[model samples]
Target: MFFHPMDFLILIAFGISLWAQFRVKGTFNKWVEVPTRTGASGAEVARALLDRNGLSHIPIEVVRGTLSDHYDPIHGVVRLSEAVYYGRSISSISVAAHEIGHAIQHKEGYKALTLRHRMFPAVNIASGIAPFLLIGGFLFQALSLIGLGIIFFSVAVAFQLVTLPVEFNASSRARNLMIAEGFLYNDEENGVKKVLGAAALTYVAAALISLLELLKYVMIFMQGDDD
Candidate 1:
């Protein structure tokens, strides 16, 4: 009938993640529809920035989904969701700029982004196996399975750490570009900050959730041993 401390912590972490997701979603939605003063579409803003940086050859494509904007370095493409691609709102411009920031990082060979990209394949494989290892370990009372889980979770943690700098740098680049290029006026700068800041919280929440989940797995393994 007793539960480990990690069980409580995991539940708390899940709650926090859900709350943060909802809060950020609401904020994004509210701001994404507010029109920008310059009336430039998100796609237009992205093109202008890339062109200004001599990256006009990089393709910009509209992907389907909310908040799905990202740069595909391998394909040299910037993909934006319909909302972001067509919207002329300050939030849309900010999000679009943020994705372009990744492309800029790729073009400039930013160290953090390069490291994160190099780790992607390993991280993907580890993440794919992590749940299976952890759950199988708990179900079968196998130390080897538990060890595998720990190794996989450690890889995931490393990925999360690498992700922090890449994302923060992208947002920093987005904000600076917006100001330097006169995409945002003095009055609209705060709105751009708010949107990007809220977006960053989702990454923070994801990292925290992953860490707590790893702790739960560790606790489960220890309890199995004790039994």
Candidate 2:
């Protein structure tokens, strides 16, 4: 009900995140229609990359949802959205290869990827309880509870920060693998770049939004302590 300077930062972060989402979707949509020279579906591309990297056992599954492709390190499976799984478009190839990149990262034990996976449990717990802690602390004017909430939320923010490099590295690997594996030719690779680059911005925007939220909670906690 009350306005604070931090509220403006939250608004700005929200706007940036919204714009990032729109930009990624628009970029993906634009390139989704462009066909690849090889005419290989996303699933085929993923399989080739995984096999090329000596991960032949890793299976590619069709998942429901737009842009939902991801590599599940726990099960050692690559999940691709229906479009990316069956579509042979440039967008599909780029996204499919990017998810495969994560599989490769797991195989190679990339430090950042490993760290992010290790932090997942703690971050999940913190994310779930942070809001309740913040609300209860405010209602009861409990500085300690508020501080605990800030600390927990900070952990989640830290996880997001660590994710940046992991995602970037995955995209980088995807780009390199696409070229090396002949998934995309010289000019076609540019579309893949645009797709992956747009996808990367979403992660950056997400991290900024998380950091802004953490800052907001810190400001609230400080104000409560002052009072």
RMSD of each: 2.0, 1.3
In order, candidate lDDTs are 0.87, 0.90
Tens-place lDDT digits, model 1, residues 89-159: 98899999999999999999999899999989999999899889877876777878988989898898888
Off by over 4 Å in 2: none
What is the alpha-carbon RMSD of candidate 1 to the true structure? 2.0
lDDT per residue as tens, model 2, 1-227: 33668778878888988998999999999998999999999999999999889999999999899998889999999999998999999999999999989999999999999999999999999999988888888788788888988999989999999999998999999989989988889989889989999999988989998898787777777776787
Global lDDT for candidate 2?
0.90
TM-score of 2: 0.95
Query: Residue 144 deviation, candidate 1, in Å?
Result: 2.1
RMSD of 2: 1.3
Give the best candidate by TM-score.
Answer: 2
Per-residue lDDT value at 192 in model 1: 87
Cα deviation at 216, candidate 2, in Å, is 2.4
